[model samples]
Target: MSKVVLITGGSSGIGKSIGEFLTYKGYDVYGTSRTPERYTDSKFRLVALDVADTTSIKKAIQTVVEGSGRVDVLINNAGAGITGPIEEIPDVEIKRNFETNLFGPINVIKAVLPQMRLQNSGLIINITSIAGYMGLPYRGIYSASKGALELITEAFRMEIKDFNIRMTNLAPGDFATNIAAGRYHAPVTKGSPYETKYGSVLKNIDEDVDNGNDPALVANAVFKIINTPYPKIHYKVGAFLQKFSVVLKRILPDKTYEKMLMKHYKL
Candidate 1:
């Protein structure tokens, strides 16, 4: 029997790409979306799900299990983006970021863990971002949420490894996607202290995203991770510079790394 794979936020962007890719690769792929009707991709089945809601997550996973017998892989790819100065971002928006990017994945993992444990074999891949490790200039909350998720994935890996289960953090640097268009920009008025800086930085961030690498590359990375017998705990996908930045952050001094990031963003 083919391996059953479940992907969250599979309606569009990277999630959709991965779902389609895995489906074509012969895996029994099921994708979750807030409005399943909106996803017309015939390559994969769609399930109505809201990762932010525990009830929806549980129901969605249960549906997949009922239909497929088991989920061999669960890709926590559903996420949202927010950009703005850390201080000016509203509390609600920060909470929203964490809910979607961090808590959402956590809930999904929780719902699926029991089944994975029972089966004694499974793979959990969380779609984190390069910013998760190196904080972005204006996208502080996004970075923080992903960073938290990365940490969570690492901890979870330790706890679950004994069950013959595996977890990996797939950190993509940037990819051309609707994420930039959908990102929430913190409120910045004309007279606000951060208006000029925020505008400049936000513009630069958008440009980078617009010129980002193909989403298919990320899908390819996901494919490799699933097929590998023992995948690395963390995989960074994208340009050499972006992946190197993550490495440099670890080896370089704090202030030196800070300077490099600021230079990249023209801050």
Candidate 2:
């Protein structure tokens, strides 16, 4: 039987690519998005969803469950970028980022776990980012949210491993996606502070992302992982050059890692 997959933030970018790729692989993929009309995939269904809204997330999951007998894979691909100095960003903005990038995944995982436990065979892929492993300038909140997601994935995987429920955290380094130019409205007035410190870092981030890995590449990676016998705990995909960055994260101490990041990001 073909697998049934649920993908969040599947309207565009990496999520959309994953949905399409999975469809080709014969999965009845259901994607969640606020703009469902734009996502017209005959092989995949698009349902209205706002990850920030728990009720909406629950309803979407319920709808998918109703349509399909089971959801075999849950791809937590719904996330956005909110970049600015930590101090400069407003508390409300931070909360919003966490709601979308962190709690959103948690909500989806919670909604799906019961059924998955009963099935005893399922895959949960969290679309975390390289940011989950390291902190970058001007992306404090975004990084913090993803960092939390990494830990959450770890704990959840441990809890569900006995049931053959696989939880994989796929962290892409710099995938070409709309997240670099995320549509976040600034809640604060004229620059309060942190402009000078974060300006260059943000510029570099924008530039690198603008010319980063294609979304389809990560989509292919996602497809490949689902077929793996023992899904890896962590999968890091990035441009060839970013290999050194991951290596730096592995060998260097925390403080030294920061310096290496500064050098790579040109901060």
Candidate 3:
């Protein structure tokens, strides 16, 4: 039987691309969405899932397992984005972002682990962000949430190693997707201290996303990871510079890297 792949937030964007590509590669693919009915044209099967809700996560996993008999891969691709100066961002928004990006993925993993252990074999991929490797201006909350997930995946790997289960973090740079439309933006308040700089940085961020590489690149990476016998703990898929940024942080002094980011963001 073909490998059964389950992807959360797979109704569109990178999740959709992965689902379609894996389907073409002969895998049994199932994608999740908060409103599955909205994606009538999705290439692979889409089940209802709201990562923030524990009950919904359990039901979605059960649905896929019942339909496919097994889930060989689970891609935690569902996440939300938030942008604002850290101080200006509402506490509620910060919690909401974490709920979707960090806590949600954790709960989904918890829901899937029992089944994965029963099968004695599985792969779990968490979709993180290139920005997760560092703190980015106007996007600190997003950075922290994704970065936390990256670390969690590392810890999870060691804990599940004996079960024949594999886990990894795939951090993608800006991809041409509707993520910008979905992201929450703290309003550029009139005459506020951060209005001018925040507005400028926000515009740059959106333009980067608009001109980002095709989502297919990430899908290809995911496919590669699934087929590999011994996958690494972390894989980054993006433009050379974006991937290199992570390396640069490792080698450069803290202040120097901070300066580089400031110059890049015109902060």
Candidate 4:
């Protein structure tokens, strides 16, 4: 029997690419989206899901397992981006961002764990971001949410490794996706202190995202991780400079790293 793969936010963007690619690779792919009608792909099955909602997450995973009998791989790729100055970002917006980017995956992981543990084999790939490691100026909330997921994934690995279940954090630097258009912008009031700075930083951020690597790169990475017996704990996809930025942040002094990031974002 083919391995069953479940991917959240699979209606579009990186999730869609991954779902389609995996289906072609012979996996029984099930993808989740808030609006199932929005996804017209015939290759993989689409299930209605709202990751931020625990009931929705539970129902979606239950549907997949009922249809497929097993979930060999679970990819938590559903996430939202919130951009703007930290202070300008509303509390509600921050909550919504974290709910999708961090807690959404958490709910899915919880829903799938029982079956995965009972089967004694599974792989969970959490799609994180390089920004998770370094704080971005205007996208601080997005970064924070991803960073939380990264840490949670690491901890989850330790907890579940004994169950023959594997976990990986796929930190994509940037991928060409609909994320920018759908991203939440924290309210920037007129004459606010962060208005001009936020605009400049956001513009630069948008350009970089527009020029990001294809989502197919991420799909290929996912394929490799699934096929490998002992995949690394972390996988990064993007251009050399973008991927290497994580390494730079690790090796450089705090002040130097901040300077480099500021220069890169033109802040």
Candidate 5:
């Protein structure tokens, strides 16, 4: 039988691309959405799921496992983006982003572990962000949430190794997607201290997303990871410079790297 794969937030964007590509590769693919009815044209099956809700996460996993008899791979791709001056962004919004990006993925993984252990084999891929590797100016909250997930994946790998299960974090750079439309933006308040700089940074951020590489790149990476016998703990998929930025951080002094980011963001 073909491998059964479940992808949260797979109705669109990178998740949709991964789901469609795997389907074409002959995998049994199921994608999740808060409103599955909205994606009538999805190439793979879409099940109702809201990552923030534990009840919904359980229901969605049960739906996929009951239908496919097993879940060989799970891509935790459901996440929300938030951008703004850290002080200006509402506390509620920050928590909400974490709920979707970090806590939600954790709960989903928890829901699937029992089944994965019962099967004695499984793979879980958490779709993180290149931004997760560092603190970006207006996107700090997004960075922290995804970065936390990255570290958690590191810890999870060791804990689940005995169960014949695998977990990895795939951090993608800006991809041409509707993520900008969905992201929460703290309003650029009139005469506020951060108004001018935040406004300019926000504009640049949107343009970057608009000009980003195709989502198919991320999908291809996901496919490769699934087929690997022993996948690495972390994988990054993006433009050369974006991926290189992570390496630069590792080799460069903290202040120097911070300076480079400040210059790049024109701060």
Candidate 6:
């Protein structure tokens, strides 16, 4: 049977590329995007879904269930990026960020897990980022959400192993995608602490993303891992510099790691 895969945030960026690549590889790909206008593929089915909305999430699954007999893979890729100092960012924006990036996946996971448990098979791929593991300036809230997701994935990985349901976190450094275009770059709010200390943080993050890896590269990695016999819990896909962040985090001491981050970001 051709594998049935469901990818959230599949209209653009890494999600869309993964859907396209997997469809070409013969999997029946069903991807969900907030906007119906984001993707079009004869080989893959695109569903309208808003990860932050419970109704949208449930309805997306309903659509997928009705269209496809069964789902084999679920990719939680819908997330938002906001750049600014934590203190400067409004409380509401922080909540909104986590709502879309963290709870969004949790809801999808909750809805899909029962079916996957019953089937005793399924692959859940989270398109997390280096932010999940490292702290970056100007993206404090984004990092917090991804970090929380990493913890959640760790717990799920252990609990679901026996069920034959795999959850893998894909931490890519920077990928060339529509994400940059979608990012919310609030001004260095008038007379804020961050104005003098981190005015360039947003610009830096955006620039790096603009010059990063192609979305297709990440999609290829996702395809390979989904097919691996013994899939690992985390797959690091990014440039050499990005991959080094893992090593630095592990081998370097706390202060050293902090310094390295500052140097890398030119803080």
User: What TM-score fits each model?
Assistant: 0.98, 0.92, 0.99, 0.97, 0.99, 0.94
Q: Report the C-alpha lDDT of model 2 over 29-91, residue by residue, as the tens digit.
A: 999898798756534789999887878988888898899888899999999888876766778
For 1-267, candidate 4 gives per-residue lDDT tens digits of 999999999988999999999999999999988999875755689999998788998888889889989899999999998898887788999999999999889989999999999899999999999889889898889989999999998899999999999999999987789899999987666899887778888788788889889999999999999999987888888889888988998899999999988887776
Residues 80-126, candidate 5, lDDT per residue (tens digit)?
Answer: 98999999999999999999999999999999999999999999999
Model 6 misplacement above 4 A: 37-43
TM-score of structure candidate 3? 0.99
Task: Please list the residue runs of candidate 3 whose C-alpha ends up more than 4 Å from where it truly belongs after superposition.
Answer: none
**Backbone clashes in each candidate structure, one number apiece?**
0, 0, 0, 0, 0, 0
RMSD of each: 1.0, 2.1, 0.6, 1.1, 0.6, 1.6
Q: Which 10-residue window of candidate 2 scores lowest in summed lDDT?
A: 183-192
Model 1 earns a TM-score of 0.98
Candidate 5 clashing pairs, residues 3+ apart or interchain: none
Q: lDDT order of candidates, best first? A: 3, 5, 1, 4, 6, 2
Candidate 4 C-alpha error for residue 252, in Å: 0.9
Q: Which model is ahead, 5 or 6, in terms of TM-score? A: 5
Which residue pairs overlap in candidate 4's backbone? none
Give a tens-digit lDDT track for model 3, residues 1-267.
899999999988899999999999999999999999998999899999999899999999999989989999999999999999888999999999999999999999999999999999999999999999999999999999999999999999999999999999999999999999999999999889999999999999999999999999999999999999999999999999999999999999999999999999999
| Model 1: lDDT to the true structure | 0.92
Query: Candidate 3: what lDDT?
Result: 0.96
* Window of ten residues with lowest summed lDDT in model 4: 37-46
Q: How high is the CA lDDT of each candidate model?
A: 0.92, 0.83, 0.96, 0.90, 0.96, 0.84
